[model samples]
Target: MPRNYASLADQSVFPSISDLPGDYTCPETGGGVFGCLLVEIVSIERITRLVLRTFDRADSPVTVAFYTGDRGRSIENDPKLKPGNTMAILFPRRHLFLDGTVGVRQEHYGYFKV
Candidate 1:
C-alpha cells in the first residue's frame, strides 16, 4: 500500500462503506482506500491480530481487521486502538463475510492509520 493511496484514490470509482455493493457475499478485489473514517468503535478484540467492530459514517456496522503479519503483536496493546478512537483504512480489501457483515480487511502494513 502506498503512503498516499487514499489521496490518489478516486472516490467515484471506489466509494465509502455505505456505498459498497450489497450483493457482494464474497470478497471483491478492487480495494478502496479511505483516508479517514471517523467511526464509532464498538469493541476491540486482540488474540493474534487486531479486530475492531465499528459503525461507519452512515451508521453501518463494520469490522476492521489488521493481520499481525504487518501489525506486530505490540499493536494489540496500542492505546490509540481503543474503542471510540478514530481509525483510517487505506487500500484495504472490502469483504462481505459469510456472517453477512461488511468489513475492511487489511493484510499488510502502510494501510492503516490509528
Candidate 2:
C-alpha cells in the first residue's frame, strides 16, 4: 500500500479528448447509444499509465480501472496503462492543450527547487 505520486503534485489530475463526450449512455441498452471513445494516459515515475478504447458500432472492448488517491485502489489491482487523449512531456513545466488535441502524458524526473 505505497502509492504516492508526490501527493498528486498540486493536483490537476489529468484526462482529455475533450473528456470524450459523444452521447455516452447505454449500460447495456438500459438507455442505449454508446460509440466512439478512446482513452490514453501515461504518467511516469509516480506511475499513472492507462489506455482504454470503448466503442459500440460492433467493436466491443471495454474494461477500465484506475485510481491514485482518495482511497485509491482497485484499478483492477493496480492496472498499468491505457486511457488516452494523448500528450506527453512533464519536465520543467510547460504544458498547453487548450481544448482538442487531447492532453496528459507526463514524464518528469527529479531535481526541483524553485
Candidate 3:
C-alpha cells in the first residue's frame, strides 16, 4: 500500500506524542532528581525532518534530530506532533541501528522519549 503523508500546514492532523509509549524520564544526576526535561518541537518538515530542543538545562541541553523518513509513521499518522508543543523525553543511554547507522533508536517515532 502507498503511504499517506500529512500536510504540515494542517495542525489538526498532526500526531500526538502523549500516549506513544516510551520512557521519557530524565536520568538522575547528583542525587537531585533532575526529572524529565520539557522539550519543544522546534521544527518539522513533513515526515522528512524533525528537530527538538530543551531550554532549561543548558549545561547538558537536549537537541535531537529525526531525519530522512526515519520517523516510523507517515506525517498524517504521526502522534500529535506540532511545532511548539512542550514534551518530556527520555534517553535510553544506548544506541541502535534501524537503518544501518549508529544512531539513538526511538522505539517509536524514531526514538522520541516523550
Candidate maximizing lDDT: 1
Q: What lDDT tens digits, residue by residue, belong to model 1 across residues 30-112?
A: 43333344456789877656778888766788887765565556677777877878776654445776667788766765667
Angstrom error of the Cα, residue 32, model 2: value is 7.9
Q: Write the per-residue lDDT of candidate 3 for residues 28-89, one digit (tens) a residue.
A: 63222322334555544343545443332222333444543555445434566766665544
CA lDDT for candidate 1: 0.64
Give candidate 3 misplaced runs (Cα > 4 Å). Answer: 1-35, 47-56, 59-62, 66-70, 74-79, 92-105, 109-114
Of 2 and 3, the candidate ranking higher by lDDT:
3
lDDT per residue (tens digit) for residues 60-91 in model 2: 22222222332222332443433333222222
User: lDDT for every model?
Assistant: 0.64, 0.28, 0.40
Listed in order, each prediction's TM-score against the native is 0.64, 0.21, 0.35
lDDT of 3 at 42: 56
> What clash count goes with each model?
0, 14, 9
Instruction: Output the better candidate (2/3) by TM-score.
Output: 3
Measured over all alpha carbons after superposition, the RMSD of each candidate to the real structure, in angstroms, is 6.1, 16.7, 13.6
- 52: Cα error in model 1, Å: 0.5
Rank candidates, TM-score, best first. 1, 3, 2
Cα error of candidate 1 at position 65, Å: 1.5
